[model samples]
Target: MPTATADVLDELVRASALLTEANSVTRLIAAMVEQANDITRSDLAAFYLRTDHSEEVSFKLSYRRGRLDSPKELATNGELVEFLEESEESVVLLERKNSPFNELLLDSNSASGVALPLVTGRSLLGVLIVNSREERFYGRARLQFLDSLARIAAGVLNNAQLYRELQEHARQIEELQRYQENVFSSMTNLLVTTDESGRVHYFNRAAAERFALDEARVGLTLKDIFGKGLTKDVFKTIDTVEQNGQTVLGLEGIYKTDEIDIDYSLNIAPLQGKRGRHEGLTLIFTDQTAESRLKQEMKVVSEERRLIKDMFSSYLSEDIVKLLVENPDLVKPGGGARNATVFFADIAGYTNFSEGKDPASIVKILNEFFEEAEPIIRRHRGYLDKYIGDCIMAVFGVPVDAGEEDTVHAVTCALELQMLVNSPRRTFFRGEAEHLRIQIGMHTGPVVAGNLGGSRRMDFTEIGDTVNVAARLEGVAVAGEIIITENTRQHLGDRFSLEERKPVEVKGKKKPIKIFNVIGIDQQSA
Candidate 1:
C-alpha cells in the first residue's frame, strides 16, 4: 500500500479498534467529540446522535456547548431548525445575516460554524454541530472534513448504537421472553434454525430461555454449546437444519439439563436472500418436562427459576464482548432482579502443571481441560462464567436463571468434578504430571449479577457472598473431590448421599464452615 494509503488504513483500523473496544458510551463520548473537535481544530464540538423516533433523543450527546440537548427543540425554533429540517438535503453553513447561531452572538462576526445532519445513508440518524470562534473558518475543506468525520462518526455511532441496541433488544427479549418462557416453558416447546456450520442464528424464546442459551444464537458455533453429551444428535440436527428440505418440529427427546428430560419441537424455517441459496433456518423446541411444568407453575420452585446468562466472549475478543454486553443500556441504567446460583470451578494443580510445561503445552492443556470440563459445567444450567488460573469460575443462575433445585443442580455439578479429571480426553503426562487433577467447589445463594467492569476491561461475573464462598472453596478443594458447604448439602437433602467433613476455617471468616464430601449412591451420608 502507498504511504498515505497505509496511514489511512492504520487509522481506520485504529478507529475500528477504538469503536469496538468501547464497552460504555461514556468512555468514547468525550473522546469521540473531542476527536472531532481536534480534527477540525474547532474550539467546540458537539454530537447528538439519533435515538428512536419517538424519543427524539440522540444516542449520543444531546447538547454540547449550549442550546437544547436535541435538535427537535431547535427544529421548533426559527432558523437553525429550518436549515436542518426544511432546507434541501445539502450541507448548509450560514453567515451572520441568515444563521441563527450567528444571530445569537452579539459579536456575530467573531465566529463561523458548520452544522451537518447526522445521517447514515438516506435515513436521518441525527445531527452534528461544530463551532469555531473565528469567522469564515468553515470552508469546503473544513466542511468536507467535518462531513467525513460525521460520516465516520455516524457509521461508528450507528454501529455502536445498533450493537448496543441489539444488546438492549436482546435483554428486553430475554426479559419478556423469560416471562413467556415460564408461562409457555411448561407447555410451549423450543425450536431453533441455523446454517450448516451450526451457527445458531435464530431460536425461539423457549429454545434460549429454557436451555440457558448465551446469546441470540447467531454468530456462535453450536459446538460451543452442544459439543458435549449429544454429539451425534448435534450433528444430526445441524444436517437436518442444513438440508433445508423438511420442517422438523420435534425430534426424539434429548437431555436438556442434567436432570430435566426434554425434547425439541425443531422447526427449520429457511430464510433465503435474493438468491434461492439457503440463508438460514429457525429452530423451535417443545419441552417434554417428564412431569408437566404446568402443574408445577402454581407451586413455587425451591430455587429461583431465573437462570444466569451473559453474552459469550471467547468467540470475540474482550473488547467487542464488552460492547455487546454494555451497549443495550446506553440510554438507560439497570432495572431487573434476578436470582441465580453462582458456580466457581478450577483445576487444583494447574499452576504446578503450568510450571512444569512449556507455554504452548500449558495453553494446550488449559484448552484441553476447558474443552473437557466445560460441558459438565453446562449440564446443570450452569454457565462457564470465566476461567481463572487453573480454575473455572461459573454461575448457575444469572445471565438467565435456574428455576428448581439450583442448589441441587450446583451440588450435582460439584460432584461431577472427578469425572472431568478422569475423562480419557484429559491427557496427563507420566510421573509428577500424573498427580495433576481437577477440583470443584460450589455454594448457593442469591446475588445481584449483571454485566460488570468497565470499557478498557470488563467481565461478566456474579458477585455476592455465595460467589466468594464458592471461589474460596474451589481453592481449598482437594483433587478429584467436590467440596460444598452445609448450605449446599441441605439443598441436595435426601436426593444424594453426602459425607460430612470437619469444619474448616476459611479466609475472612468468623466461624468454621462444615464441609461435605459427595460420596456414591451406595455410600452412607454419615
Candidate 2:
C-alpha cells in the first residue's frame, strides 16, 4: 500500500472506534462531523439527523474551520435536501452552474461540496455534508472514506437513541415508586407487605411505630418481627389469601406480651403485579382495643341489670319492677300521696299457734304461707310491700298506677290467698299444719307511698290512715276470712260476693268503719 492509502485506512479505523464508543447522540454526531471535515479537507461540515422517521432532517451539529457551530434547521424542501433524499449514492456537487447544492456550503463563494447519506441497512439515519471553495474538492477517494464513516455513525446513533429512551423510562419508574411509598407512609392504619415466603419487604410508618420496627426489619421473616405466637396466625392468614387469591378480612387476634395486650383486626390481601401475577401479601391491621373493651363492659352491665330485675321481681309487680329497673330514679327516697288500696294478710292465730311450737316450725309455716300468697298478689298487679312478723302487706297503684282497678286487684288477691291455704291438697309442717289459717283485710283510700328508710336502708311501702285501717281490720278478723272496709267494696263493681258486717272500730280512727266479708266469686256474675 502507498503512504496515502495507509494513512486513510488508519484514520478510518480510529473514526470507527470513536463513533462506536460514543455514549450519547450529541457526542456521536460531533465526532462524525469532525472526522468528515478532517478527512475531506473541507472548509465546512454539517450533520442533519432524521426527525423521527419523517422526511425532514434537522441541523444537529456542524464544524466550520476547526470550530463547532449550532445552526438552525435546514429547509426540508430545499434543493440540497431533495437531492439527498432521491440519491442513495454520494452526491458530488462540482462547480456546476446554477446548482442548488452550492448554496448549502458555509461560505456563499464555495464552489464544490459532497453530501453522504448516513444509512444503516435500508434505513436513512441522516445526511453528512462537507463543502470547500474548490471544484472537485471531494474526489472519489475521499468520498469513499467519508461514506465508510457515515455507515459507522448511523449504527452508533441508533444505539445512543435507544439508551436515552431507556434512561427516561427508568426515571419515571423510580418517581412512581417514590410516590407509592409516600402514600403508604401517610396512612394511619398499620400496613406491611411481604413476599409469599413471609419475608418482609415494606412496612408503613404506622406499622413501624406500632411494632417497634425500623428499616432493619426488612428482609426479616414474619416470625422474626412478630414473636412465634402472633407469627403463626399471620402466616396462616397469608397462606389462605395466596391459595384462594381472595382477600381475607376481619380476622381478630390478641397481640399479648408481659407488659401489654393489644386487640387488632387483620386484613390480608394478595399483592398483584403486572398481568395479575401473585407477588406477595399485604396485611392491614386495625386497632380494636378500645372497641373490644367497650363490648366486654356492656356485657357486664347487661348481666347486672338482669340480676337486679330478678331480685326486684319478687316484691314489685313485673311491670312495675321493669319500670323501676329501666328508670332507677323512680326508687328514690321521696314519697307522694296517691289514692291506693292497701291489704294485710296475717296468720289468724300466729302468736298462740307458735307459742307451743318450735321456732323452726313456726318460721317454716310462715315462709310456706308467704310463698303461696306472694305470686297471687303480683299476678293481680299488687306490690308485695313487706312481710311483717307472720303478716304480708301489699299495696296497689303507687309506683305504677292501676287507676280505679287498684281496689279490685287488692280484693281479688285477698280471696286467692284465703283459698290457697284452706285447700285440701295444701299441707305445711309435713301434714301437721292444718291448724294454720290466714286472715286478710283490705282498705282503699289516699295513702303516702314510696321508698321509706334512712340512707343506708330502704323499704317500698305505704303509710297513712288507710294502711292503719287495713292492719287493724286484719287483727280483728277470724280464721279463713277476707275482710275489707266499705271503701274497698265501692270499687269491686259486683265482681265478687260480699256480706255486710257491722261497722268495726279500728285504731287511729275515731268512728267505726263499716266492713264486709268476701264470701267468694259470684257465680251469676261469672
Alpha carbon lDDT at 288, candidate 2: 80
Model 1 per-residue lDDT tens digits across residues 134-250: 667676555655565566666666676677779999999999978865664454556555664557765555566666675654677666666653447656765665675565554
Q: What is the C-alpha lDDT of each candidate?
A: 0.59, 0.78
| Candidate 2 residue lDDT tens string, 299-362 | 8767756755764677876777888778655544467888898988888777876787789878
Indicate the residue-level lDDT of 111 in model 1: 58
For each predicted model, how many residue pairs clash, with residues at least 3 apart or on different chains? 41, 0
Lowest summed lDDT across 10 adjacent residues in model 1 is found at 301-310
Cα TM-score per model: 0.36, 0.48
